[model samples]
Target chain A: MWDGRLLRVDAREQAMINEEHRPEIGESFPVHAYYSDNQKVRIHSRIHYHSYYELVLVCHGNCDLMVHYELNAMVAGDMAVLPDKSIHSSFCPPGEDTQVLVVQFMPDFVYNGTLDTVDSRYMAAFFNSLRMKRHALFQTGEDLAMLQDLIWKLLREYQEKRMGYTVYLRAYIGMIIAYLIRRLFRNEEELINYLRDYHRIEEAVSFIEKNHREAITLAMAANQANLTYNYFSTIFHKITGHTFTEYLNLIRVREFERIMLGGGNSVSEAATAAGFDNISNFNRVYRNLRKSSPTQVIQGLRVAKS
Target chain B: MWDGRLLRVDAREQAMINEEHRPEIGESFPVHAYYSDNQKVRIHSRIHYHSYYELVLVCHGNCDLMVHYELNAMVAGDMAVLPDKSIHSSFCPPGEDTQVLVVQFMPDFVYNGTLDTVDSRYMAAFFNSLRMKRHALFQTGEDLAMLQDLIWKLLREYQEKRMGYTVYLRAYIGMIIAYLIRRLFRNEEELINYLRDYHRIEEAVSFIEKNHREAITLAMAANQANLTYNYFSTIFHKITGHTFTEYLNLIRVREFERIMLGGGNSVSEAATAAGFDNISNFNRVYRNLRKSSPTQVIQGLRVAKS
Candidate 1:
């Protein structure tokens, strides 16, 4: 997946660059910026990884961003930080008229010495944002505008070569990371907390999705994550902002609602099918979580359809 | 002077750049900037010219700035705007630790369209400031600090490559020019007024300097610049902010004071040497301009010597 002629570099030079630093960036100037307007961006040959952080911002139109095994639809103003060694490609259909601005630079460009310093939060956040992005879609319109503005500023600084330009460029990159930290990961403490449980949380979420049709317990969920019961309960609240039982019930209720909306199943029938064997327990959990009883939700969906 | 390899480009490339656009700039990027800290910048091989305007601002230490036939000693915070085709070089003494920020770009980078419009005044004022600098040292400490701040901002914006960096750069360049115009040329109407007669005033001032020891008259000064009496008078007032006779007297009084300060001569003889043949007229002009009679100036010098 990493090997391809579409990325464009002399073979020996590419090898030297790979050994020395990264592709699309060199030791002379450890930053590379490009503004591309492509109607159709091919992905098969373009799937590759790099040693630098790649900021790909869609200026206009829609594209599908492929990161590892994930394919997510991305539209105008959507962006993603493809971290070092993350295989990613952006594909678009013909006549999509997608415009994307890509800026890739070495991590050390934003890192001023040690990451322990207070001034290094932006650099820390840069790494954290890339790692913590469960949803790569940058949701807020204003936040997207601000990020695009930062990219534009970076491009001008890179191209103009103004006085103290390197300083300006690095500083702006730092600001971009700070902006992402605010918009993406929330805050430093939360980001650190998220990073700690990222893998564990993913395991828990996937396990619940696959086993929703069968009986599931907190101990079973903890065993799936290879964690002890008490440890799993404590960490689940810290990571997902919900306890194992509550999260599991919320998932079951959501599935039950979807089944009821799909057609003629009674609330109790759908609730049992979604692994909620106790009808009274399901009704109580659904009313508490959804602020409405299962019957009311089904009636509301029917009213909308009618 | 134009024949030198120090300029660092092949002849064909130079011509093509001079024709195609400007170096350190392309059609895509119209502005370029650089911050330099060089202690010993040699001038012997550094004399060159370009198609774009270059603004060199000294951040620290001192250097000898050569712009055309004028050689001025520039100290820290001093700056010079080298307009297109201006023969210029900066020579520094070794180990002085001089730092400077340079911003260079095609003129059209500032020119948004019609030169005659008010929107283009900043560009015009920018070019005019380069020409109207009778004191290119930038003078006031406050003004120097302001310009330095602007340079720093430009350097930061240039390096950061933020979104709308081009817009920010172009706007900042316009602002730098605006600041200079206000501080250097005083006001807009006055700036426009100065620019109109800038060349003619320069010619008149030089004519008076060379012919000050002779009998100088308003008509002679006007004819030297190939202008009529009334027209020259009007232009002289607009350009120098002084009437032609008042300016000529001001110059004569200055030269007369210089001669008297040298000593060993009577006030009358010194005044005659400065081309004030009528001693009574010299006394009146000196009293009006210096607020002291020639005899009193000589007496003050003698008292200081004693």
Candidate 2:
């Protein structure tokens, strides 16, 4: 996968910020860990988005990385957070071995449990690309030192499968995320600056999530956004890439499937549980997106539970 | 964790069978994988039972294992299956580094997915201690060779983690399990002979599982076992180590909690959904087992989603 295009980066290209790039780590837990020296040739040159988050720590030699579309120098001991679904890539710097360690995991790794409860208002850093643009590299002396300690701790936890290592792994990763939030961003306001409508969108999205089980209309969402119906409809699509009704239906379908897997029986019951008063419409939307029937989905769940 | 008690095993111990010993992997999935050399000492010598399943493959050196309850020799290329909730232990035999690979995961890792759809009777090797006795180790020439190939493939998939490694890992493990069930068992009758009361006990258990939502009595259970009420009660307790009513309540509480987490709202609703006709009794049992109210669980799930 390597294109063998390592190059030097001056001041200008290093400052450019890439947008709409998201990367994925594939696995959700026990972060994907890799170490390489000469094998660094496989750090592909393709600039792409991953569906999960990634953490790259320089263990030996030096390198340059284009994270979120910005160039940054990574000497030995440098580290950076490639936020979930963010665009990033790595390259070997001229005349360097660039031995490094990579640890990546899916958003479900931290986005599922206690860390998610504090709300996005508190988790502004993880959702912000601006912060990722400015402080992409852990270059500050204390930040680098602290990060190295955490990285070694993670490597130790991964290397040694002691009792409750999963718990430790998550806790250590939580520490890393918490550290990034507290240390990387100057304050909460700056962290949320990437998206001017971030809070409004978050609140509107939260409202839709809370009421997806109820009879919701476009006007209701527009009012929740404190915008005129037309503007709200337009901006919601612009921000989320989905129409208001479409997004609501998506939420409902996801919840419907969750209910089915969680042991709710029957298509009608799951539909109602997922906030659908009309069975035919729910089935239509479900089939449209899933390309499968509700019965088939429930049967799959039954098979899973068998 | 090493007890410094390595020795040669006589032919007598090499032929013994261990019973009722369950080994736990703690984390369910995508599974806990570990590589060890001298680090094998960390596996401990407790000779204890675990709540989850485990797989141990000897990569280097020779050793003897206490699987279930019996001592057996494990050399290079030998692999042992530590069935869930079965008693087992390991010790490094004299000479060599005793390098090995360990893959451990919780019951839910396999029990919840498509693997369960085949019916536990056909997948009986996983649940049956009787079969555990007949074929704990893949020592036969063909079985050992096939297992080594699977183990190496697993190790490679785990180590390199090329694209879609998680999908590949699950598939490899499934293949391994399928191979065990197919290759290890001599024949259908041979497989059935390993378990004397497998069918009867399975039928009685299935009945309780199906009827745990109703007001099930000891007499009902005895009738399912085709034994007199008193005799059935005695054997049920003897086989399962729990009285019929106690086991029934356990099932009810577990199902009740499952329903609550599955999106059933309100304590009363979850209780009813779990098959509890009487509120006070269900509440008492739930509190004793969970040490928290159903409301707390719902709130926790909410936090998990947030």
Candidate 3:
């Protein structure tokens, strides 16, 4: 099991095995907490990614978390920070009975769209995990135990949904993030680098989001960060694991679906409104990003609504 | 000692007795944490106020905190939430050896200028304290003890000035605020009312901050809140404990001082830049609000710098 053979999966095959998981989160709160065990692990054994940060703390038994070419073995009191959209999977041997607490939250849940330096600094650990291509893992220790206790309280608060639960949840998550930053990044230089990269990509991401409907291009995004087209493209891919065009199309497809699901728009109308000039191109990009035809997803949405 | 006579101080006398205390806080990280005991309390015994929220947790002995016409007798494990600029004083009888943990922070330190609903909701207890003319006091209990642990940790973090102390300090404070909201306001309606009032006043305050250099009026502020001039004035005074004109002039005086301290500007130049049209009128308002003439304060500033 210690052999490094499992780390040699081909890029194309890894992409084929990866799945996107969108955890259910309240729009206003944007945080979800739950527990995962071996049985749950088997059910979701495929490499998976989501568009929000996930923090996992092991409670019992042992498991291995794979992020790209690296594997981290985790045990009781061990914790892992999985940045958003990082392809990874978890595994536990038979009879291990591994249990882990999981917390998933959007960046907005913590910072709430404020561009303040300190606010973005809380996200340093998450961004570092993505940039390094290795999940941030904390082994069994006193600090990890303290954080585990907080995570348990967070899960309880989420389960109970008591009065002012959202406020409490946000506070708990903020504390956890702070703990991660204080532990993971030892010096000021590491944090500063992470913060700088976050802002650069964040600027490009924000620009794309604001003007995705206006036929924006990669060069325009690069200009937003004052970087050359080639360097910006390379950094964007390294950080996000997606080419700039791929990320842009993913956003456009998501917006298209949102417009359609809001009930009054036709497929072609949404396609155009979401920045696609041609239906064929829109359908192809939607399928590539979502692994489903646009029509099928729309039908599923309608069926679920009905 | 519990007699109601102490609660009958006249408003004019209270104003004369109340002093403005500006706690030193770093601009980037606007939080200051310290411990206060009877000796320190006596030094600051006169009723005083500051333009920042302060949380006080009693660690030992007994003290009485007088806010406006009300008094709260606080003992060990008691905590008090004092809103910004709320005239209040603490008294500990001789030999009590009272000690308390004090955490003062600007509202921006937590919410960071986000107008998000939940961000404002974290401030409910503070606003409620100001509106009700009574400080929010949490008595000894299990929950308070838990919060006390966080506060102690916060004070340690503040003292240590570690690598990411600001992030940790902010997290601890956020948790404390969440605990306050969860414990103090048992229901949603109270929180909703407090949140509404915060937003209303916050809107007018933001307007004054942004347009103070121009000619603005109480009527315009009322229009911002969509309330009549008389009603807005009443609510503003009830919430802030200062008449509309008093608060406006106080803001102007603060702006004027800020300009002068930045250097190179004559007193008249700074006063005009801060929206004061006449030097005499500026001096009168400055002396009334700050209890010091403009020239005197400016000279004091220069002397201190030298």
Misplaced by over 4 Å in model 3 are A1-23, A39-43, A112-114, A117-134, A193-306, B1-23, B39-43, B112-114, B117-134, B193-306
Residue B271 Cα positional deviation in candidate 3, in Å, after optimal superposition:
31
Off by over 4 Å in 2: A1-30, A38-44, A93-97, A112-116, A129-135, A143-146, A156-166, A186-306, B1-219, B222-306
DockQ of each: 0.01, 0.01, 0.26
lDDT per residue (tens digit) for residues B220-242 in model 2: 87788887887777657655656
Arranged by DockQ, best first: 3, 1, 2
CAPRI level of candidate 3:
acceptable
| Worst 10-residue lDDT window, candidate 1 chain B | B1-10
Candidate 1 per-residue C-alpha lDDT over B87-167 given as tens digits, one digit per residue, 9 for 90 to 100: 456677657688877788766665533424323444555565554333245653656787787778778878986433444
Q: How do the residues B91-184 of candidate 3 rate in per-residue lDDT, one tens digit apiece?
A: 7776568888889887667764336655455465445554344457778576666766888899998898766777677778877877777666
Q: Which of the numbered candidates is closest to the native, going by highest lDDT?
A: 3
Error of 3 at A237 (Å): 16
Per-residue lDDT of model 1, residues A1-306, tens digit only = 222111211122222122333453754566877677775553222445567777778788767776643666878877877766565565776666888887887766555345243333344544644643422456547677877777887798678754334544555665566556556555556656655665676788679878977888888889999988898888878666568787788667667756765674777788898889888888788767656556666675455334
Residues A1-306 of candidate 2: C-alpha lDDT, one tens digit per residue:
222121111122222223223232244232655566745364444454445567787876777776532467778877777765454566784545667777766555544333222223334445444222322567535566666666676677567643334434554565566555555446656545535555556678779988999998889887888988887777677556578887888778768866766667677988998898899898788877555677775565455334
Query: How large is the i-RMS for each model, in angstroms?
Result: 15.1, 16.5, 2.4
Q: Give the range of the ten consecutive residues with the poorest summed lDDT in model 3 chain A.
A: A3-12
